[model samples]
Target: LGNTIVFPYSYKSSYKSNLLGSSTSPIQDVNMEEEFELKDGDVVTEVVDGIPTIIFFDQVHKYIERRMAKTIIMKLLGRSIGFNVLLKKITSLWCPRSPIQLMDLENDYYLIRFNSEDDYNKVVFGGPWVIFGQYLTVRLWSKDFSTSQSKVDTQLVWVRLPGLPEGFYSDFLIRAIGQLLGQVVKLDAHTNSARKGRFARLVVLIDLKKPLMSKIKINGRIQRIKYKSLPIICFSVWHVWT
Candidate 1:
């Protein structure tokens, strides 16, 4: 049984009888015991309802550490997208160092594995990605992730404050203005340094269920808000359409 992968099983006194099945083979019985022996912290037990529950802690840890570190879980909000289409679009957009593996999960969720950590970080921290006029919500993969229970209502969107006063470029002031739109996630380097005067750019986590703010008033002056890759919205009916 050397180098053979043994599956986890419950320990019982009749385990030898079950494996032998009336055959009196001492060697076979010894091999069976060796195969199922709990050794080297390979298996951990927890008492549940007066029964020991076996946990393959080492196997699970290795799987997650090697496989899931550069993996991300994502889902397209308010729409169902095909696997091939999503793969094609995101591959082209991300331009990863190596080809990515895309797997479709339960519900509308998708799992993406990247070969490079740089690619993973870029996609995770990247803008509220928009595909086919719909927002793509992205999150890091966790061991206890559930497709049905995971719901996304907010996205990190880039908002441009046009004609923002030069004095408002300070980090504190910009963040304060960003609160009017949504939770401030980050500020563009150029915007924070005041190198770009056209508009102040910052990333905000905006709620998708609410109407997006088109303009904001500052010091009794109207400042128009520009959203990047935003879906079409009908102001008359206050309805947003993808």
Candidate 2:
């Protein structure tokens, strides 16, 4: 779908991952060390349900989305190409995806959804929602896979954004990895904790920001990670049953 223009950016060099799923949210410290602040690769790992924890990234990266705004959605059938520049430049905000949107539930609580009757009377703007069974779920899912009496039903849920300010994603290229498949892929990170020495551990159940929807898996786990600049919220590993 992104056939219009190609960016002069390289995906590999601009990012790097760690071999261990360690805490990546760089601990804020003024006198800690410059090497720790600017150095890339912060690993975050955790254990859950007797299974090795997975690594995921919920970075509040101040992403500057520069794109050639299209005037029309059509093929090159000798049609006049209208020039469209970027519109609605929002700064210091949140960025959602074209599918599901990040929303504010109330106070410090936020949820994701495609649609919601519970929010029927609630005033919501610039968000995403969809129909799910009898109720609307933020992590929207498709119809049940079972039509038989013995079959079971399931759906993929949209992932939730971090506790970062919703304003950080104000109209950014929004994308939601539902809770059902919260981790779009797997990767690794290099982490060092007082309990665990500096080492690389394979990270599982990992997902990236919208731009990095591509999944990576190997050796029953993944290593190396490039995270976005986001405020720290949680430091536990998340596992989404595949």
Candidate 3:
């Protein structure tokens, strides 16, 4: 339903028809290597309208888990926010030539499909990313992604801290937090004057050499870190094998 925020995996088709379009044509089955094959590069091709069509190249969808609406709203405002906000943010990315398919699995994960490979690449390669005031942790969705070890050398982690004590901004504090967590990528701080004194807010996006499941508390205030993702593998295959 249009109003539903979460649903079981079986609902994907019906949901797609209503929200995206009714373009679920079936592809003829094709054979794959009897044994599992490790492939290089991230893209696949299909024959559509007598032309070769390039697709996401990756079998699974990649997205930012910590940037999802529910988890982010809970971590930042400490409450659940409406799904419409998330939809609006995603749709605003661009006006597409064809409807882009999006589904929030409610596992702090989302899946997106674009009609054009160009649009998909723009999203995948574009930099300086943020969603609803939080830094995004992007990844490809796959069963093996979570456990893959040959990922890029550095992965950026987004963090937000509220209710900092007055005059708490200092290099020492930033470096200390990074040391406690991972390498520092970017830092953001906002200061506002209050009747009593000035209070400050801080946000940090760090580069993690590896995935860490640690939490940090600064001056009794717990900071929510938004950096966790699965492994990514790239390969090019025929659509019939999808």
Of the candidates shown, which would achieve the greatest TM-score relative to the real structure? Answer: 1
lDDT of 2 by residue, 96-199 (tens): 22222222222112222322232311212222222111121112222221213121122122233333223223222111221223433211221212122332
Better of 1 and 2 by lDDT: 1
TM-scores for candidates 1 onward, in order:
0.57, 0.16, 0.32
Of 2 and 3, the candidate ranking higher by TM-score: 3
The lDDT of model 3 is: 0.39
Q: Which ten residues in a row have the lowest lDDT in candidate 1?
A: 1-10
Cα lDDT tens digits, model 3, 43-63, are 577899999897653422332
**Clash number for model 3?**
6
Candidate 1 residue-wise lDDT, 1-242, digit = tens: 01111111122223345335435523234223222334667777789999979788776567556656777777887888876677667876777765455666677788776656677768876755878877777766767677775565455667899889899998889999999988896799999999999999998877767777888899899999998744455544444442
Better model by lDDT, 1 or 3? 1
